[model samples]
Target: MSCATLFPRLLGDVGGTNARFGWQAAPGQALQNIRVLACADHAGIDLAIEHYLHSEGLDRPRAACLGIACPVTGDSVRMTNHHWAFSVQALQQQLGLQALRVINDFTALALSLPDLPADSKIPVGGPLRGAEQAPVALIGPGTGLGVSGLLPSQGQWLPMAGEGGHVTLAARTALEFETLQVLQHRFGHVSAERVLSGQGLEDLHAALRCVRGDTAPQQPLDAAGITRLALQQGESSCLQTLDMFAVFLGRVAGDLALTLGARGGLFIGGGIVPRLLGWFEHSGFRREFEDKGRYGVYLAEVPVWVIHTEHSPALWGAARALDQLH
Candidate 1:
């Protein structure tokens, strides 16, 4: 079947915590029946898709596309932060789909960058413009950190996907180094995601207590709860945790920009940063991002935009991928 003519296509963006799905009927039609499903509510991807389709009262789709929060190297896909594992070919057969395409969730997000409207993106800080032709970098923190980039070629954008979030973390201060030591004891290899994700916020809060010799066994807090404590009660430890989080994010994003020379722009996506809102715009994230000494000036020219939307824009990205598929 020709890709463009495929109707009732299923578009999805599967994250560690949530799976967002949309239905597109015919070409150039706005996605309908957009829904967000908790990953834990369903047993696996197939069940989740079935539940979505059932609830929407939609028929079987001819083609389906997904942006999953894991490596889609071959037919076998094992989620990095969840237990759901399946073969892509098997899934296509089970759904009786004529075609099914899957790619890294962040890669799909990258594909949607150029098409993103100006208002949908909130500029955090930096010069107002970026080099139009340079690579555009993207990194975001959610259940795990996601990293990807878009390389401009022949007036077209090509998305690059990799597990850049698993890269070794770098520490900038004596306190940060000490914190890493504490984290090392708790988790053997502290990757960037260890200190930059949702769980990372909670773990960092506890690790900070250990570093400060706070022997008082306080109740554990999740990311939202921790942020509540910081925002509502001005808890000192919680405050510091968020502070360090922004700084670490900046440094990591800076490293990405430097590596890709992403002067076109650097986009921040995912569930965490946008919630930070005002605090994030004023946080050390930007400072640490440009703290690369001699290279600070270069980074200063790289524009940074934070993606915010009530629904998953990745669904549109999946739709675009389907259109591109031959």
Candidate 2:
């Protein structure tokens, strides 16, 4: 079916904290009326969509596609980092849509990568370009961690969605080792997400404080507050937390690149990394990414790009999903 005929498709990129929506009126038409809504503000996906359509004064769409932060096995869908859950078939029926496609959020993100504007992505290290036919890796830390990729398949890009973020974490350095021990004690089997996400940032800060024995009475801080302290006020503890964050992120990103042979590129997404670009480009991210002893030479060749944009490119990915670009 021609995607152009699927006019006025409803596109959504739903995350843990926020859900961004857009309208693709036709195949070549730019996404219209993009809006970001707090997930907490709505009761469910159905309500959220209804609100958006009503607010925009848009008629019911012929088709719809949503990329949510969860697994879409069978018809049932549930978000991992948030409380929203619904059956795909039920939503389609409720909205009276001819088709409703639901997919993993990061998968949609991977789909958007090939069409990303050059200005939207800033390369961090290695060659400006990578192996043309090789796979690409993506890892991002936000309300939670999201990991995915795209591989060349039959002259097409196949996007992958898996829980790579939950893999067991590896650590080096005295502080790193001690912090890992603290995290393991608090939550058995420390996953990479334990130390790489927004909540992970807060938990990591607490763990570092516990490990370093700096029990000084101070105001509690979330990821944003911690970032402010480190970036603006030059707080020592927060600075160390971010440094360790870069080290672990680099290690995990390197591991993903090796696992997938993703020489095409390793792109960093999510809400956290882009915000830390000032400290990130200068931090140990690139160094640790290539810190592998035997694979150092190979990893050094992989490029890394940080995505920076206000609009969710995943919204486009959702539209692509509706188009069956798989």
* Runs off by more than 4 Å, candidate 1: none
What is candidate 1's lDDT per residue for 1-326, written digit by digit as tens? 56777888999999999999999998878999999999999999999999999999999999999999998999999999998899999999999999999999999999999888888899988877678788999999999999999999998888998999999888979999999999998899999999999999999989888899999867888999988888788888999999999999999999999999999989999999998887889999999999999999999989899999888888888888888888
For candidate 1, give the lDDT of residue 52. 95
lDDT of 2 by residue, 4-51 (tens): 467789999899999999998877899999999999999998999999
Q: Give the candidate number with the greatest TM-score.
A: 1
Q: What's the lDDT for candidate 2? A: 0.91
lDDT, candidates in the order shown: 0.92, 0.91
Q: Report the CA-based lDDT of candidate 1 relative to the real structure.
A: 0.92
Error of 1 at 283 (Å): 0.4
Best by lDDT: 1
Candidate 1, residue 230: Cα displacement in angstroms equals: 1.3
Candidate 1 root-mean-square deviation in Å: 0.9
- What is residue 165's positional error in candidate 2, in angstroms? 0.8
